[model samples]
Target chain A: MTMAADNRPANAVPRTANRDPYTPQTLLEVAVEVFNERGYDGTSMEHLSRAAGISKSSIYHHVRSKEELLRRAVSHALDGLFAVLDEPAARHGRAVDRLEHVTRRTTLTLIERLPYVTLLLRVRGNTGTERWALERRREFDHRVAELLRQAVSEGDLRADVDVRLATRLLFGMINSIAEWYRPGRGDAASAQEITEAVVTTAFGGLRLRQ
Target chain B: MTMAADNRPANAVPRTANRDPYTPQTLLEVAVEVFNERGYDGTSMEHLSRAAGISKSSIYHHVRSKEELLRRAVSHALDGLFAVLDEPAARHGRAVDRLEHVTRRTTLTLIERLPYVTLLLRVRGNTGTERWALERRREFDHRVAELLRQAVSEGDLRADVDVRLATRLLFGMINSIAEWYRPGRGDAASAQEITEAVVTTAFGGLRLRQ
Candidate 1:
């Protein structure tokens, strides 16, 4: 099982495994859960220490502060997302085709890393780290927008739709995945299925007829 | 020119024109701003008073307390949304057509009442009012999902797509309008243009060929 699955609580903090001592990675996994529950600003060192069964001072030994935890969590999400852009399918295909590949990978990554990504989506640009993450997120959006613009330029997408509007529309569909998706629900649709539906709805409107 | 323009700040308390001094409507406008700023749970009556430029005792003359203010604000947003369901376009058209109308109106309402709607979107099931609002929101979703199901049954929508997925995909496109859509930039698309773009993208692929 993945660390995320083994490490997370269904709705709150996970159990501390007696087998492993506290490390930055283990502490982050606990901190992310507390952050999600009480919210980033609402959570404090006391909460993290209690959840991790570590001294508050010990947590500081591994990370600078709660903000560092947030930065690390969001970075995990960003890295997962940016990595999708470098995949062969995202790079080597027709603009529309490449976009579809990115869209599918994005949905899958979001589902697979549900907690990290959820925290990423909830950011409101309050702190320096948060503002940085938001900037990077906009950069990611612009990169994907460039692909949509290229698709429109190549006549592979509908000419009537504005590319900027189309980009937001595509991302709107992708980002809302965080609002409703829950992992490990017996009846929940698999990430592939969710990605397929999103890609179909977004690209279905843009793809040129043969 | 419109009250909406006066009420646009994400956290600025709205002041009423009446010198009668305080009404529930005016008090709610101020309370919602505080709630949006400090968050529903994070806010206190003192915070509301500071924002409203009134004393806690004076606020009680208008609102019972902070939670009452949250109830009123969410109730206002719920009423606006439910009102859309009763419109002629939403009620009298073909299922697919009606869904498009709902999608458009929902997007417009969300943008027009951006702060209130943003607050509504961010609520977790923390209190009685929040839970009630979430249940109502789910009912609204299920109602729209039923329309998509009906359209598929009538062969007016693509049978390949899942109805629940389609409903979420459509609203994902709509709810996202709140995230980055600024009101008055010279380059910003008008509300009509946005509604049109959202409706077109939402239904373009789903509509059966004539």
Candidate 2:
């Protein structure tokens, strides 16, 4: 929830702990939530205004357009995921090891920024901002696909599976987390357990090891 | 494309061949495409009319409301998937074998009914029809989860991963096919190969076999 507040643009966002006294960052948070609840195309600025309990002008004052809020929200998610690729574990290691590291970190990032990442996954390239988001997503997938190819060549990961197909399925399973993972309900697994399950299920497969 | 026509309602639908001719069945086809392209909520009767090259009243004549189209579309998807469970291969086998059979069949079903299933996967439960779709989807998932549980009990599947989580990840990967799978393209893998890849990756770990 505080994710937007943590990375402030200084003058662009007021330093307030409350959801009120809207900052561009905080307002972006509201917009992402609404965009997810009502499909992005269905959501109007009026909906955003109502969700924030503020006037349209108040929303307009913070962000130039709905697309701007969208750009910022998806950027926040993409930045977090791309940052995982830049981490030391992800950057330098045996390719399979690095892929595992990136997978784990990416899952955590999705959880930490659930609403924002949810919106990013649902983007369908209708607007300029959406198209940009899709391109960046493709770039991220390509990087991970390279890691998978390297792992296959190195003989660490299974060579029988197609690298690109494996990449899509692997990330596809990870992204599927957005659809159902709810953090900290009474019966839900802890974040660590969920992360462990993803890593185990992705690399190890579901067949019982002999 | 002929899926909509295969099982027609005796009294409710007209028999037609061309997309422009506007059979109730064919109109449902057009409406499903538009619903998926524009998120269901974002799509209006006007958009459907434009997409179908028919008047709004013409559409209303064929289907009472947009929700009617949605109901039929998702029902087609759900029926396809539920039929997989009733297959002899899926019904009579070792728990793990049945699970794999269902997995392979479900992947093929998703491909066969790709557009309908894609729209089904994206429903968010905003309307009564959407909520009904959500409920049926949950029922379908529950039955699959039961098979996973059985597999684990028989020690054919990994006992360590939670059954529900594994079920989600498995189908999540299968369902993820809707995101990028395009059939019959020049360079794309054949649907047969895609189904094999899903089976291999889901049951066999991505790591090289010893």
Candidate 3:
């Protein structure tokens, strides 16, 4: 297991062989890993260089600072999540159906972009970048909550439960995946299996029987 | 809001007057507040002293070390949780009913002991006490999983959903209260309201219909 060196600032760019096409992506991946291990505050540029086999200067070439890397990483996760909302299935279906689609897609995205989402979940808003990411996250949550409220209004969901509470319960199930999931483990249960379980658990009493 | 000073090591105790019984509890309360604010790794003994309105040496008389305070705080939360299992509702009811009771009690405990539970959830096993706390958390999860399995066996829960998955889903709903719940923010939504919402949302996906 390669660990980032402790000397330089965490976001430092490593001396790359050359300007590679994947430098940004590669550097971001390394940065996410270091951020997870040492935490955003504890990681240093020297650490990134050792992890990425690049010099600290090379890292700076990719991103301005550790917070910038954090922003980029969370943005990637948010983009993946929001893109699912724009999919044809997510947009045109019944509210419940759309919610199912969103849940499934969110699970898949989280798995595919586990490191990014993990970092996003860990943000505490100590910096402007973190606060911005948090605000964006709230917006995403509110958007989904609107769909849930629509479902309840359409008489497809139970009226007794609060929409905000229900929305949180649903995503809580989804976001907790980051705490325990490891990529490439045991066929790792496909997103379908996960989304199915989540939907079933969520809609069991929530949905009106067809 | 008062913030804990971050000048002391994890093992150093604060010094204080020997006669005050409330001093230890007050100091501990202040310590937990600081732990929640800056996180255990980021906080120092000086932070606790300043937060408690006492000198650094004063804190030492009550607790042996910073980790001891963490151990004590989370232990209180853990005991509150485990005690629910000993309640008549949890011990004597049908599997589904017992599970619901446990869920309700756990949510209430989390709210009533918010800071301790928050600190508990944030622990990353970086030290002996932290690792132990994490193990206890897993044990708590496992015990709940057992009750869930019993519910499934008694035909009180959907068998289609994997028991482990369901357990995680349920606890995810409950544990998530720590992330956003504040002590005095909402009107008409008392602590009871939050706990009931969690129980309703959780058991809605659980509990076999009549």
Writing each residue's lDDT as its tens digit, candidate 2 over B1-210 gives 324444434224432223336677667877888898887988999999887776788788788899999999999999999999999998898989998999999999999988899999989889999999999988989999999999999989988899888888888899999988876667677667888888888888788777
| Model 3 interface CAPRI class | acceptable
Ranking under DockQ, best-scoring first?
2, 1, 3
lDDT of candidate 2 vs native? 0.85
lDDT of 2 by residue, A35-80 (tens): 9888788889989877777778767778889999899999999999
After superposition, candidate 2 runs with Cα above 4 Å error: A1-20, B1-20
Per-residue lDDT of model 1, residues A1-210, tens digit only = 125454434224434433235667767877887888888889989998888776777777888888999999999999999999999999997887887788889888887777788889878788999999999999999999898888777667776667788788888888898888776678677788888888778766421233
Docking class of 1: acceptable
Write the residue-wise lDDT of candidate 3 on A77-133 in tens digits.
Answer: 899988998999989977877877787788888878888988988887888988998
The A-chain TM-scores of all the candidates are: 0.87, 0.90, 0.84
lDDT of each: 0.78, 0.85, 0.77
Weakest 10 consecutive residues, lDDT, candidate 1 chain A?
Answer: A10-19
Error of 3 at B77 (Å): 0.6
lDDT sort, best first: 2, 1, 3
DockQ, in order, for the candidates? 0.42, 0.74, 0.36
